[model samples]
Target chain A: MRRLPVYLVLDVSGSMQGEPIEAVRQGVQLLISTLRKDPYALETAALSVILFDAKARQAVPLTELMAFQAPKIEAGSTTSLGAALELTKTCIEREVQKTTADAKGDWKPLVFIMTDGHPTDDWRRGLDVFRQAKTGLVIACGAGPDADTTVLKTITEAVVSLDTADSSTIGAFFKWVSASISTSSKKVDLTKADSSEINELPPPPPQINLVT
Target chain B: MTDQDSAQNALPRPVERAWTQLLEALRQAGVPSAEEGAYGFGGLPPEVRRVLTFIDRRWPGAYAASDSATKIEETDMPPAPADPPIVATEQPAVDAAEVTPDAAEGMSMAVSKQTILLKNARIDQPYQETIALEGVDELELIDDADTGLALDPEQDAAILKGLPRHSGDFLLRLRGWRADRPCEISAHLAVIPDPKSLWVSKESDREDPFWKPDAVFQRVEGELLCIGASKRGRAHAKDGLFRDDHVGVSVDAASGWHIAAVADGAGSARFSRRGSQIAVDSVIEHLPARLQTHVSPHLDALVAAYLSQAPDAEARLKGQLYRALAAAAFDAAKAIEAEAAAHDQTAAAFSTTLVVGVARKLEDGWFFAAFSVGDGGAAVFDLDAESLTTLSLPDSGEFAGQTRFLHKSEFVDYEAVAKRIFFAVRPSFTAMILMTDGITDAKFPTETLFAQHAQWFAFWRDDLAQAVEFSRANADLQAQLLAWLDFWSPGNHDDRTLAVLVP
Candidate 1:
């Protein structure tokens, strides 16, 4: 079976403390619940979480929807988007199953990056590293006004912005992500194709805005 | 070359300039940097390593004197940026000798702030952190009911033992004496439910507005021994959703015709269960009735002519068979459309794929006619001839995961509907199988495989024969067939409907 690997790159910077961080945790829970209900996503989608603050670490490895445990995320110090991007690349290389001669591999991974602040590290170098890897869709979401869409633009062409990182907005973003994963899972198998553009995904909710 | 090579070649010049400026600034404020530079920047981040590699490759180790600090030849180096090799410090060095357990006060261990554990999984130690002391006093977990963790007080954060029964976020508070100072700290841990345990089988409510049975099974024993079962997928069972697949099998004693139909409802459709039910029902109800009415009177003459290789008679029989099968399918689609319209819904809301096969024994051979719309398959397997005749053409739509469904427009053209109606005469067919996408996608994943004789044979031998006992006409055959439909296929957990006919 060819699984659809989904990578969620989240920012747990100091500015994202309290309600924002709590909202992120709830958003993850909401995403899981929504995806579990979708038969397509439940069948093919595997999820992984990479959290970045002072440094980046994989809170959860690539796990199938049934087994995935929503990790307890905490807000830390700086926004090391560079480290997060670099770690995402490394995780994708390590965890995603590759197509061998005898067997089908996983679908190209879909990466959803949500950050609330500007990069506090050398993110361009990380972007350079990320660009080398093969991925399906790389959607970078700027969660709050402080999030730098310009920096996100350098990372991926599919960028979205939210006015605030509140629970409802974050919840809506995760809902859209669940729908995207469901759509991607169904499409990839139905058409034997991968999605790389934002338009391929369902339109974002009112709380989210696409950053062209 | 590769994309990485070009990417590295295109590494911006400003990064190098920034690196050179930073080194120059560090040198101006340095205090004997070369002695501490023996590690060769090995533990630095990739960004730092990339810059170092870039500078070294361009300048031939001019800045990488740190690689061999002992063998420094000052005369062999350029003089413009004259400076001793320097170490890029990742962090300020901590003096180990000055820091004793007794001296260090109010410092937290490197324990994770938020730890995640799997429910019912035993962990000797969830984390590797340990607090070192004289072995007299150790950190103790203040056993909380919320936390399903049991810690050994003798060892400081060394072992966390227990099978966590519940799954949720929990707070773990710790109390211990570090450096003889009573210290208290709290950490958060989340235990997740096991995936296998999360698979709950909930019965779909009969009182629900759009209720359908969790499974349906039927069997007929006669000249054509037929058995079919349609079961709700595990995904649907977990969510208490209806079984969106339907199967119908009928044996006409007078006409000697065995008809079997399998219809799969579109997963995205709101009322597809009814659509599938209507599709399979109409095929069984109308096709046999149409055949009996239109072809029964001329059956003997048609068979005699076909046995004598009469081209005109064969064409007439084929035309009648096509008309009967097409009319059944057309009726199924129209009925679904009518239902949708009555409910003020679009026909898409009741989308379904239909595959129906009618088989009968004749003088020449066993005659089979089929009509299909959507992705499932219908095939006649002949063991003696070692041949398989596929009766249905899969209709894959332009979009991903999209398949053409039985709709009013599907049967608009007579030529098109005639094309969908396929007929074959096999000398002695072992079985005819009509299956929904659930079975086809799992057993024969690709079109190439679906078309292969070897694939059908293997499916009969390995998958079907292993799971079902067709020779036994016993009462439990229905259960056996239903059990066979429950074969595990990862990522292929759609509602499965399989109808088999054996002459």
Candidate 2:
């Protein structure tokens, strides 16, 4: 079976403590609940979560939508976005299937990175490692005014900036994420083609502005 | 009550009657431990006292020790307890206060028996629910962001103004007011999935460089009934993609020869649809003529050599049929290569899987021969013989999801091409079936299941027979087969092509 693997790299730093972190929690919940209703996403799309604060860890591995359980997220210390990216690449290497002489592998994995503050560590090294891995669309979301779109643009061409990290705005971002996943899954299943760029995704919501 | 009633009888009638009424009201109001002293009697809340007063007026002398207690006339009662509108009904069964143990003094605000406002509401459908609450003057429904529902106080219901975006169990939190007291109650609303949302048909662009119909069906009734259909899968149709599968069939009554070709275009190839089209067409154009000129005159000799079990004669007959099918497959592979060259595209871009079956009636039975490339299957089902003869070997890899396609390399060696050809003889058979991976993977699922007779029997009897009415003739049979191609299998959406030759 050709599975559509999705990786969610979140920054659970100290700056995201109050409403922003709570909204992020709801945002993840919203994404799961929304995708569960879509038959195409439910059948093909698998989700994995990577969280970074003082340290980075895989909160949830690649799991089918039906059996997936949303993990409890909390705000910790530093913004270890670099560690999260490295961990995401490592997880992809361990989890995603590759095409070989014996069998055809899964569709290219989609990576979504969300951060409220600039990375506290050296993200360049992690970016270099991530670039070497084969992936589909890597969309970076910068939450609130503190989030830097210029820094996110270096990571991927598909970057979206959120006006605020409040519940409603973060909620809209997750909703757009669900729509984008649905579109990508439908695209590969129908055309047998991978979605590599941002134009293939649905238009982002008002709260989320696409960064060129 | 037997001991308590007698003990209570020892007290003075007026004090006992007053005390009994107070105690009964306190218990009904759920106020624990009210003493007989002045401070205890004065300690009762105003609402509880009002309820006791109302109860005394409504059911006079009911809780009194003596009949004379009815002298506390209605004139002394405060004008009428009208604020809460707790209409303690004559029938206890329908009383709202009796229904809820926590009625909060005189407030009888209780949710009605309809605890579930909505059951299995479908996504993107309009829904409206009116809740019944007793002793409630005004009701307010909390807005649930996910459900997309709003409170319509004028309509006195929770109206799903727009289509519901999500499907799940939603709790509708409602707050109703009985005078100053606020009562909160929740009702369950369940939303079911709408399967049709999973499939959306977009119109294919005819202006594209490589364009084909979304679906195709063909039927030819001669010595044999040949019905074949190819349909764009849900996945392809959703994005307005071309049908990457094709079927070509020919049945000649004069020559007593019938041939059916089914091909599946590689999904990754840009022009594989054209490749599949050229493949099936090349076989229909070349194979039937070759069988007519070469095999027709030797029919009697071949049948005699087979029945007599003469090795030399039988090998000669087998060689003729094998060469015919193989040559046809080779021609198909060559034509695809030429077309790819003309379009300035790689031959691999025109990759496809092809399965062809040729049948000729003889004195003993029907002689069936087939040549195959790639993963689809071709088989002859013989009900009388209680056997299923698989005519072609699948070119699937060691694991699933990989299949070999028709290419020049596959047919370059004469011996290799001959290995792909198989022959069988059956006096009477049910049907000759040729299908692409779309149909085979969904119906057969596993190789073990595909190789079993019982699976094939169940597939034919329970699935195919129930779906298509083979007894129907001509156009009707073609329509049924084309419609039957729309059968759903989870994680198995692909371009489907099927050919069935029934005697």
**lDDT (tens digit, per residue) of candidate 2 on B1-503:** 65644543353333233445545555676655434222332345444444445444334444443434223344434333132222221122223123333322223333232333443356788866555566554454543446876555356443334466787767766555443344555665656566556677987889987798988888887767888889998878877888889998898777888999999999879899999999999999999777877678886787777778877875676578666777788889999999999999988999998999988787867888888998888888876677998877866755335677888888677777777888777888888899988888677755666677777888888888778877535446767777889997766678899888888
iRMS of each prediction in angstroms?
Answer: 5.3, 6.8
lDDT of 1 by residue, A92-132 (tens): 99989887643557889999999999999999988888877
lDDT of 1 by residue, B1-503 (tens): 46534543442343333444445543554423445763344433333443454345444544445445523244433222121111121111111112233323212242223232433231232423343334223445554455555555455344655566665456666544333233455644545444344457889879976787888888876688888889997667777889999999999988888989999888779899989998888888888789987766777687677778897976787678766887888899998988888999998999999999888887667888788998898999887789999988866677545788999898777777777777777779888999998888788877777888889999998879767877644667777888888787766667889999986
Over the full model, what C-alpha lDDT does candidate 2 score relative to the true structure?
0.75
Worst 10 residues of 1 chain B by lDDT: B85-94
Docking class of 2: incorrect
C-alpha RMSD for every candidate: 17.3, 11.5
Candidate 2 local Cα displacement, residue B146, angstroms: 11
After superposition, the stretches of candidate 1 with alpha carbons farther than 4 Å from their true spots are: A11-43, A49-108, A117-138, A150-159, A165-212, B1-164, B168-212, B238-240, B289-321, B342-344, B382-387, B412-419, B452-458
Worst lDDT window (10 residues) for model 2 chain B? B85-94
